[model samples]
Target: MDRSEKTVLTNMCMIYDDDGNVLVQDRRDSDWGGITFPGGHVEKGESFTDAVIREVYEETGLTIETPQICGIKQWPEDDGSRYIVLFYKTSHFAGELKSSEEGEVYWTKLSRLKDLPLARGMELMLRVFLEDEVGEYYIYEEDGEWKHVLK
Candidate 1:
């Protein structure tokens, strides 16, 4: 028996400043589109940490430092592959902030997130990024229905 499985790795980083604000990207694409952090898929042979760093730079034009792995969100794809997103947070960074074709990047108060139009499931993902107690967000199917949990 071959006990092997396929997986897709991705990442998202919440870059915060000294003030009570965080960097956000207003994605232009409809697929997974909305207000979210800057990140992208991890390429082959690249480390998770390196992937996040590169993705952030590509999308947000900021170079982050000492990015702390705060949590993760994982779900199963229809093709039996697992999709995973590594969550990171950092208050340390440098460089001019710019936006890519992916979205418009800007700094906003964390308290005002609820008022913004956020991407689906981002509300839960935010818990992982902001709360120290919660470290994981998982999605699974049961009885032909989708459900989720945070750990």
Candidate 2:
């Protein structure tokens, strides 16, 4: 593996409303262009909770309460490296929705998530996050296109 091929730890915020609708972002300049949650890489010396809070606010313009850690997803690339992403869910927050270089942000019903353009392994990840209890890990491998194997 090349030096550039390394697994990175990342964090994502699943901002949901009391109605179970989740906030999703539409990417305007990413290869994986579609509706996604607000999140980013964990910066040096930043706690997982802090990273998600900062990322969500930066991407959505909303100051979110510290989200509860819900799930962990390992997304493997063809090069054998993967991005380890932590997922959190929070319904309590304060601020107006806004946009950033990350993408346009909006809220969508969880039931309609499958209709939106999402990252390769997001379907399975979302399933695990919604259907399972908090604190679980889901491993996925991209088979080709947007298909994946969940383990």
Question: Best candidate, lDDT-wise?
Answer: 1
Tell me the tens digit of each residue's lDDT in model 1 across 4-32: 78999999999998889999999998778
Error of 2 at 37 (Å): 0.9
Listed per candidate, the RMSD to the true structure in angstroms reads 0.9, 4.0
The numbered model that scores best in TM-score is 1
Question: What is the per-residue lDDT of model 2 for residues 1-151, given as tens digits with 9 covering 90 to 100?
Answer: 6467677778888888889699998877547767778898998788989899999999999999959988887757777777788888889899999999989999899889999888766777786568665354555534544434444
**Model 1: ten consecutive residues of lowest lDDT:** 26-35
Off by over 4 Å in 1: none
Q: How does candidate 1 score on lDDT?
A: 0.94
Q: In model 2, which regions exceed 4 Å deviation? A: 1-7, 76-82, 133-151
